[model samples]
Structure formats: C-alpha cells, structure tokens
Target chain A: MEGALMATEERSAKSDHADSSTGMLELRDIVKRFEKPGQGEILVLDEVDLDVEAGAFVSLLGPSGCGKTTLMNVISGLIEPDRGTMRRGGRDVSPDDLSLGYIFQEPRLLNWKTVRGNIEFALEARDVPEGEWDGRIDRYLDMVNLGDEHDNYPTRLSGGMKQRVSIARALAIEPEIMLMDEPFSSLDEITARDLREELLDIWKREEKTIVFVTHDINEAVFLSDYIYMMNTDGEMFARREVDIDRPRQYDDPDIAKREAELYREFHEHVVD
Target chain B: MDRLTRYLYTVASIIALLALWYVGGVTLPEVIPGLPETYAALVVVLTTPGPYGNMFYFHVWKTIEMLFASLFVSMIAGTVLGVALGRNETLESTLATWIYAWLAIPSLVIVFVSAIWIGFDASSGYFAIPLVITPFVGLNMWEGTRNLDTDLAEMAEFFGAGRIQTFKDVVVPQLAPFLFASFRSGLSIGWKITLLVEAFLLTRGVGFMFRRYFDQYDLPTMMSWLIIFVVFLIVVEYGVLAPLHERVMEWRPEAEGVRVTE
Candidate 1:
C-alpha cells in the first residue's frame, strides 16, 4: 500500500499534466441539453458538480436514466456540456486532453485485429513512443491475466476474456483519467465480480484516476473510493465515501454494512 | 477432419453432376458429348497447335488480357462509386436507380452499342466490359457499405483515430467480404462480357473460336474447350480465392446456425 502511494506521488511529480494542488480535476455547474424532434429540449446533465482528486477511483452510481453516461460522454469530450466549466488544475481543458482512456460498455474491439493488435491500435492512436508499445502491451495484458491469449481474436474469446482485453486496452494508453461507462454491465454476475476485483487490482497498481459509471449499487460499493449517487432527473443527488481496506473480501461485514446504509439512500434518491 | 469431410462432400457432389452428364450423353447422343468423347476431342484440340493455322494460344491470351484489363477498371470504379453511394444519401438516391437500370440492360445490347458508337477496335472491346460489369460489382458494394458496422466506426473515433486510419483499419476490413464477393462475380461476369465483345468485334479471341465451333455444331470440341475454361476457373477458385478467404477471415469462429427453415 505504501509502495502504491509512493508510485502515485512519483507519477504526479514527474508528469506535469495534472496538478493536484488545487483539488485536481474539477467539473463545476455542467449543463447539457438535447432537442428532440417533438420535444423542445431535454435537459440531460443539469448543472452537475464533481471534484476528483488525483489518483482516486470515483464512480457515478445511478439508475438507467440518470445521465451518468451523458456526464461520462462530457468528460470524454464526445459531447460538450452546454453551460459549465471542466478544468484540470485550473486549466480550461476537458479530461480527454490528458491522454484520456475510455472503456465502453461493450468490448468495442476490432473483430479483425488479434488481442495484441487491439492494444497496438490504441498505442498507435495515442502516438506513444513506438518503442514503448510491446513493453506496455505485455505489462497491461499480463496485469489483466491475458498474457497467453495475445494471438486470439475477439470472436474466439468468452465475454469475460473480451472485457479483460477492453480493460487492458484502456490501461495501455496510460491515461491520467480513465472513463468507464458501465463496462461490465453486460457480463454475467460471476464474471462481473471477478473483473471488478481485477479492476481494483489494476487501479491500485497503476495509481491512475478513474471515473467509472454504473447502475449497479453493489458495483459502486465494491470498486469506488467515492460514490456520487445520481437520480433519474439528471442530477447527482448524493455522495458517499467507501472507507474499506484494500484486498476487500467479498462478504466483509463492513462492506455489507456500508452497502446496507447506501441501499436505503439509493432507493430514496435513485429508484424513487 | 473438417477439411477432409468438406472435400469428401464436394467430391460426392461432383460425381453426382458427372453421372447426370453421362446420362444426358447417352440419352441425347447427338447433342451432348460423353466424358470419353470429350476427353478424346480435348486431346486432339490441345495437341494441335492451332485450328486452321491460327494459333489457339493467341486467342486464349487475348481473352485473358481483355478479361484482366476490364476487370481491373470495373473493380476500382465500381467499388469507389458503390462506397460513395453508400456514404451519402444524395448520391445513393440519384445513382441507385440508374445502376439498376444499367444492370437490367443485356450485355449483348451493351456490346452492340459500344461497337456502333466507338467502332470495332481493341479499345472499344476493353471499354465495353466495364460498362456491363461495373453495375453488378457496385450493387454488391452498396449493400455491403449500407450494412457496415457503424458501432465499430464509433469505436475507432473514440480511440482518436483519424478519418483515413478509421477507413483503412476499421471500414476496409468490415467491407472486405463484400469487396471480395464483388471481385469474384466481377471476374465471372467480366469474362463473359469480354467474350461477347471479342466475338462480335475483335478478329482474334477465344470467343471467335467459340463462334466457329458453334457454327460447325461440333458439340465434342465445344464441350472440351468449355471444360478446359472451367478448369481454369476451378484453379482460380481453389488456388487463389479460397486461400485468400481463409487468411482474411481467420478470426471468425466456425459455427453452424440453428435451423430456421421449416
């Protein structure tokens, strides 16, 4: 644990991209609206405020129509929030400018490329020094426990294997802020559980800030340091902190207690 | 074992076709030449350097040359037009009807028009095949481009790939099966149109030789020549196309679909 913190300190010191002195990545009063053909305007993200510390895992916990995805999209620069400020260390830059890495809900892998080739595609897109590619790919895929399956194609893989590749692809970019939009939502329960554990492992080892989005309350409880609870009206209604220790057991009494506490709050705000 | 079973099934199919041909030869001896007679005539025709001092190799070479030249032009033009039509609504709406109309016009009529307009020349013959063949290739590509996986394209965009890289890396691979299918049909249709153009217009080609054998009503020689031509197509199919297909789509998992037909 001390070693991971030391690495995070060294990483933040070495890279001038993100400054944590002013509370790191900040999103304040973000507003976005979409116009339907019949409807005049539909407000998706309404003046949302979020502050992410450097090298922390934050999840937006919400139900299906809660604008978690739209906020994620805003962070990734896929769409701009109409009236808001998103700044990295007081600079008017969105999250993507800092070599943003994204993992979609689907694997979204190129079916033609091999497992190794998929990572290579990301590496090329990032223009990471070509010399560093093989090393990064090897380390990330090894971290994801996909070392032996580099030559396999996506179709040949199971759902879990493909999601692992997606994780490896996202991490291979070495982004300062990694955005995941319900990445493990479609997987079976057992697979999702295993991947959540593995994701936490990678998160600790890499020490990169992650903004994960999911509708699963337990998923947010298990994975995040800070869970921003959101409701169906495009508002982040509440926030909670999970203070569980690392390498958390599945049936830890403290985790279940925290989940039980959040469950009531989740129902009151989100499901209602 | 899969390869062996696949080859065995194909061999069985070929034997069944040959048995039917033999029955037809026995039943209609005057019209259909049996394998024995066709083989005999094939030996005679292949051994003789030329038919009546005109070299068969020259005609064969001309037909092949014309086939390649026209197919090259059509494949490029067709794929470009097809992809363009697919990517844009205005282009698709304007040209799709004209392309179908072109496809409906007979290859014979196209050749006649080319002969009358351009005069009987080698250039005219080369130019005529694309006119007949491009529409079919374009239609194949149009359908493929329309069904292209836009999800993959979006993924490419999220990865920060440029337009060129996305088209080359993502779009091209998805459209490859359609491109290859168009190529195969283009080769088949291109050669037939080449024969039509050569027979009516050019002085030397396999199509002219076919016209002669057709005039004489020499069923055995005609069948021999046809069998040899089909052998070339078989060599291309197995030697070139099948291997390329395996390499390109090696990522696809082999599985049978559930029965949908009643």
Candidate 2:
C-alpha cells in the first residue's frame, strides 16, 4: 500500500509540472450527418465544438436527442466529421498519435472472458508489454475494488459490477483521455452515487483528462470541473465551471448550491 | 439441475426404449428379436471371428474408423468454408445456394457414379462423407457469422486492437456455439453417408457384413450389429459433444446449473 501511494505521489508531482492551460482535446466545426432509411440526411452533430483540459474532468450535459453521444463519437474519432478539424494540444494530429479508452452505456465486455481476461484484452490491444500485464491488471482491478472478482465472468456479474469491470478495462490501457458515454445512467441511484465518488477518488490520484457524457444534472454537478450544456438542436449553447471545492459530498451545501444553479441553467436552455 | 437429475433423464429414456423392445419382441418375434436373444447374438458377434467368413471386430473397427475420419474431415472443411462464405458477401450470394445443392443429390447416385467412374476404395467413403455433411455445418456457420456484433468491433477498434487480435478474441468466440451445434448434427448425418458409401462400394467392412446379413435373412445378428453401433455412437456424441458444449458455453447463464437442454 505504501509503495502504491508513493507511485501515485510521484505521478501527480510530474503531472502538476506539465501544461494545464491548453486542452488535451479541441474540436471545432465538427458536423456529422446520418441518412434516414426512408427520408433524407439528418444532422446529428451540427458544427459542435468542445475543449477538454489535460488532467481535468469535463461533462457534456444534455437531454436526449441533443447529440451528446454523437459529439462523443466525434471526439473519439469513431465517426468522421462531415466537416471539422480535431486537434490535440492545439495541433491537428492523426488518431495513431493518441490512444483513447471508451466506456459505453452498456458494459460492452467480452462475456466469454473472465474479468481479468477482459482487461487483458484491452492491454493486449494497447500492446502493453507481455511481462507488465499482470501488474497492470492487478493495479487497475484493485483500483476499481474488483481485485477479488477478477476470476469471475461478466455473465455472472450484476449490472453495477459489470460496469465496474468496464471501468477497470478502460483504465488498464492507461489511455491519454477517458471517454464515457452515459456510463452510470443505467445503474441504480445508490450504485451510481457510489461509483461517482469512486471515480472522483481515482481522478484525484491519477490526473487524466476525462470527458463524461450524461443527461443527469446532479451527476454533472457532482463529477465535472466544467459542464457544457447542449440543446436538442445539437448546439452547445452554454458552459459553466463549478466553483465548488473538491472531495464533494452528496449533501454538501456547496454541491447543492452548484446543482441548483446547474438545474436552473439546464432547464432554461436544454429542455425541449 | 444437478448431475443426478441429468443422469436420471438419460436412464429414463433407456428404460423406455428397453420396454418398447420387449413388447415388439412379443408381438412380432420373427422381425424384432427379444432383448436376451439380441444380447446373445451381440456376444457371439463380439467374441467370434466367423460370420459368413468375416471377422466382426475387423468390420466394427473399420466402420468406427470411417465414422470419425469423415466427421473430422468434414468439420475442418465446413467450418473454414462457412467462415469464408459468411464474411464475404459476393461469395455468399454466388455460391452459398449452390453449396447446399450437394445435399439434394442422393448419396446412392454419387456412389454409383463413383463405382462406375473411379471404382471402390477408402477414398470413396472419405469423399462421400464430407460431401453429405459439409452443407449442414456450413449453413450454421454462415448464420453465426452474419450475427457477428459490429458494436464490439467498434469498441475494439477504439481500443487500437489489431486485425489478428480482433479475429481471435472477438470473432472466434461468437461463432463457437454455432460451430458446436453443426458439429453434432454433422456427426449424425456424416456416419450415415459413410455407411452408404461402404455398403455400395467397399468389400471387406461392416457395411459389407450388413449386405451379407440382409441376403441371408439374419434378423438377430443384423439387429445386434445395429444396436451395438448406435450405442457406440451415442456414447461418442454425449461424452464428447455435451462436455465440449459445457466448456465453450460456460460463460453463459445457468451454464453450470441444470437448465433444460431440449
């Protein structure tokens, strides 16, 4: 435990020295269109723009049909923009230059593999050295509080537990940026709250850029450093930086105030 | 369900079969031999070497060899062909329908043509078995291939997975259940085609003994041979395929506990 704490301390010290003013990811004029079967083309992301600072947690807060997921897909380069320029460190670069870890609304695990094997699948895809695999799996699974359940299959896991495994799988790759698409929206309230705190704790220890997509106002207020509110027309019309302090609580007075302000802003613009 | 419940179901089926056999013996003695008489005939066939101057174990060994060899050959060929056809749209549209056309052509015609054209040998049975069973195996594989989850592929691609890793980890496991199902059914049909080829063309085999038995009107001996062979096949299918299905599909729900297989 002391050794792990020391390693984490060393990591945070190095990250603190690095640049934080510029966003790790910057998107401008990103537009994506999907063709309806019987009808014509419909714009899913209409010149959407976003910026995610290095070592900071950002939330894309929006209601349904607001293209929150489509924007996330554009940021991850899964869907090519009909017209846009995506840049890393304020310069355009190829996807090969950056590795991304994605957490879908569903766990999206390989049910045929054990929890350990699932993470190993990601590590192998990232081409982590074969010898370093065991330590990485142990650390990440332990971080997710799933060290003991590594041998279990996803089929036998509860919904919350499976989602935890997916989190571990993504973190195992140690990607440059973590992309989550409504990751906790499907879980029960208690599980979601618990995972939110766990995620915050991990974020504190290892400062990686995270772009979380959610429709829940409370979730956005609790987890993100900055919240970008998008409307149903796929336009990001508002942005806010939560002024509350860290180690936030479910019932913190400051959190409630931030949540109330966020809700008011969300209702004014995001609701259809 | 536990092991005992599964074992009991199998035992119950065997008892029902034995009861039916006893009734058939009493009602039609000349046609269906009694259990005791059949057992005695089986003992004779197993222990002795002389039946129309042919050794029983020799023929049994030959037929058993044919059964497995054909299945092994067909399984490899069919699975590879299925995966290929399933992944390629042009190949599927052009030749998938024609592949099943092999099934509609009777095994008898193929045997007669082979006899008239190439004459008789082990090669004839080997060719005939895979020809009869490949389409069934291939069809299941094609359907499984079509259902390959592209969402999972997108996830893998996002993770920077290479082509080989995607095929091994993602593609292969999804096709496993379909492959196992087709393999079992292939065994059932492939062995029959083996028998057809053996009886019509080959001279010194169990199929030849079957031909000789029919000629001499040896009902007890014929029934004994069939009963023993079928029992042998039942052991193989259950012992090998059932356990294999359990291992491959162990990640599935209720995989360990008893669920209704049928």
Candidate 3:
C-alpha cells in the first residue's frame, strides 16, 4: 500500500524532471562495433538514441549481448561509439573529463579495505577537502542501512552487503550520472528483491540520474520509470514508459501484471 | 599425539643425543675428548670476556648490519626502477635481457668485483651483497606490481588517482605480500653472502677468530665457534626473520582466523 504511493510519487517526480530539463543527457546516432582477435567486426550498438533527464531512474532491459551494457558504457564515457556524440548539459564532454560513477557486476571492493575505507577511497582521489569524509561516509552508509558495518571488511560481508557498499562508494562521489551493469544479477532472489527496493529508496532520496542495465524484465519493471529494451544486435528496438505509482510492492497487481507482460514480451523477442 | 607426549618426545631426543656425544668421546680417547674436558674449556671461555668470547656476537652483528644496509638501499632503488620498467614495455624489454644476465652472474664474481673496486675493507660486504641481490629483488617486485589486479587499477584511475596515489593505495597494499616474500628470500641470500665475504675479505670478526683457531691447531675451539654460529643462525631465523614475516603477513584481512600462508 505504501509502496504503491511511493511508486506513484516517483513516477510524477520523473515526469516533472523530464519536462523541466531539455535532457540531462542526449545520445546522438551512436554506434559501437568491436573486432575480435580473429573474427570480423561485430556490431555491438546500432545507431542508438537515448534521452535521459537529470534525476530520472531509467533501466535498459535486454538479453545477453544486447548492447545495453555498451550503451551504458558509451553514456558513461568509458567507451567511445564508432559514429556518435553524447551531449551532457548541452555540451560535448570528453571521456577523460566526464565524471561517471560506475558500479560493476562484481562489487570490486578493495579486499584489504573495510566498507568505510572503500567508500572513502572514491573521495580520496578527488580534491574533496579533508574533514568532509566522516559526514559524507556516514550519510551514504546510513542510506544503505550499513552504518553498523562500516568497519567490516568486504570478505566478511554478504554478497548483498558488498553490493550495497559498492553503491555507497559510487554515490559518495555524487556523480551527475550513475551507471550500474547488472549490479545485483549475481545475488539470490530474496536479497536481489530487497536490494532493488533499497536502490529505489536511494534513487528517491538523492534524485541523481541513473542508467541501469539488466537482463531481468521483472527487475526493470519494478524499478524503472522508463524501460528501454534493446535487441541482441544493440538496437533500441522497443521502449515502455512505466506509470506504476511509487514505493511499488512486488505483490501489487499492477507491478505483477506489468512484470509478467514484460517477461512474456522479452521472452518472445529473445525466442524469435 | 598429545601435547605432553610431544614435549616428552622432544626432551628425550635431546637427552639421547647428548648421551651419545658423551659416550662416543669417552669410549674412543684418541678419536674424541671426554665431555668433562669440553665442558671445562667451554666454562673457561664463557667466563673470560675478551676478543674470542665476544667474537661470535660481534661477527653476527656485522653480518646483520651489512645485510640490512644493503637490503634497505636496494629496496628503494629496486622498487622505483621496477615500477618504471614494469609500466613501460619498451624499457622492460630493453633492460630485461641485461638484468637477467646480471642476475645469473655468480655471487663469487660479484664479491671479486667488489674486492677489485672497494678492496678488502669494511665496506666490502656492504657493496657485495646489494650488487648480488638487487637484480632479483627488482625483477620479482616488478612482475608482481605489473600483474596486480587491473580492475582495481582502473577503479583507482577512475577515481582520479595519480601515480603516487595509485601506488600508495592500490599498488602497495596489494603487492605487499609479494614484496615481503621477495624481501625474505633476498635477506637470506644477502646475509649468507655477507658471511662468505667476511671469511674471504678483511679479517676482524668471527671469520678471523676461526682462522686464528685453525692456525693454533685448536680444532675444539673452531668447533665451538661453529656451534656458536649455528646457534646465532637459529636465533636470527626465529627471532628476527620470523617475527618480521609475521608482522608483514598480519596486514592480510584473513589473518584473523587460521594462519595465512602469505
């Protein structure tokens, strides 16, 4: 009941953001192709266009090798597209200059560092001005509900906790854009479900732009305000604007029906 | 199997060895001296404080001092050169052949080279050990630093970590075990070579004491000093080397439970 209200609130907020900003990010005719060592050129992304308003939670849904990850990478300025330009805040930003927070599929936490240390490392590199660390670390750890586990090492934490730490590490930098590549794809169903809710809460609290890539249709439907579905060859084949109200519950009828329908749709597309 | 039984077994082994030594020395008078006579000599030498009595401790200290001096000098020089070489493929390839060939050159050759350059002086061992051991240390640490987790390296870079920050935060912490392992091996080799150099070079320490005993035809005194050297080696192995190793390995997060094997 509360989840539905939160979901509605999130949808309205996203709509407002979309209308207010021309677009925080605009992808112009992007194409990415890679050449294998011996194999010929393989087209990964095919003339993709994406518009993401600032502070919007958007999910890119597709099967494996669908170029969803490539698109995210291109948007993050980690990789260059063969023939395209990405404009952020109405200016062309180079890959080296853009500050995009990336969350890998693996936690990628420094094994030697504790959870707090891992988060602090992100700020350590930038000129974050000393003495601002404790407040920032505490704020994010509290958001992830990991305030107690600050001193715990990555090895000691559960997979879900490690992923939460990774998220915290990313958010500590307060990036204009956050790119997550199936960050919860490796976890068990129950933990993944809980983390999805936690992630939505974080997205709500911070209101930072997010681009999430996942093969799971239900995950996309449950979390995303807008779902951009991609084909195996890296084309943005279909897109769905979700209107499910905020704080959405997995058990809600609208969420369940939409999840099932998206699943069927993706399954059919993957099969054909 | 039991702790008490293990303790008893260890005590019994030592008692038996001592008994065999006593019996063998008494039974064969011409071949071996009695335990009493050896003990008498040991007591006289131990009670007297002079060059002979203090020789073993003095020599052990010399060897350790020289070894560490060489190690300290080489580690700084080696790590800097190694990181530079590891990051640049062209430099690595250019220097790889020369470095390996230099490493292959025997310690004896290096000792002779040190003698030629520095002469038979106090600095001989110091010069010799680092020259013999630096290449091996540099190469091993270079490879370890090169093969470090690239994903973590990328993460460091994405966080705007410059060379120094990457080294301190990412490289050092991850490469510590490897670096320490190389240090242990280098230290062992360095000290052994220092002792050999002491025996061959300027004669003032234990090596000089051994030579004097040999000249006087005192085989027992030579053997006693040999025993002292063995005891000194044991002390260093356990007291110094082992503790340092434990300290380094303690940095590992897994060291809390079962012993981490580096």
Cα-based RMSD of the predictions, in order?
Answer: 6.5, 7.3, 6.3
| Candidate 1 wrongly placed segments (more than 4 Å) | A1-23, A37-40, A269-272, B5-20, B50-54, B256-262
Write down the worst ten-residue block by lDDT for model 1 chain A. A1-10
Q: What is the full ranking by lDDT, best candidate first?
A: 1, 2, 3
Enumerate residue pairs that collide in model 2: B1-B258
Model 1 per-residue lDDT tens digits across residues A1-272: 11111011112321343456544777888988988789888888867887677778889988897789889888887887898898876788755566678899899999899999999988887778999999999999999998988887888788888888998998898887789999999989998888988888778878778999998877888888778877776776666778888778878888889989988877765553
Candidate lDDT (C-alpha), each: 0.82, 0.81, 0.76
Displacement of residue B133 (Cα, Å) in model 1 is 2.0
Candidate 1 lDDT over B1-262, as tens digits, reads 5889999999999999889999999999987788778878888867777654646566677888889888888989999989999999999898888988899999999899889999998888877898888998899989989998876776777788887888888889989999889989999998888878877887878777677788898888888777767787888889999999989998887675321111
Better of 1 and 2 by TM-score: 1
Clashes of each: 0, 1, 8
Q: What does candidate 2's lDDT look like per residue over A1-272, in tens digits?
A: 11111011112222343364444566777788899898788887776777666877889988887899888887777877789888876689655566678999999999999999999999998889989989988998899898888788888888888899999999988886889999999999998888989988888787777899999888898898878878776677666777677787778888888888878866766454
DockQ of 3: 0.24
Docking class of 3: acceptable
lDDT of 2 by residue, B1-262 (tens): 6789999998999999999998999899987888888888888888786644547767878887887887787788888888889889999999876987876888777777766766688877777777778788888888898899988998898887899999999998999999888888887787677778877888766677677778898877888788777887888877887888899888887745532211
What's model 2's TM-score?
Answer: 0.87
Better of 1 and 3 by lDDT: 1
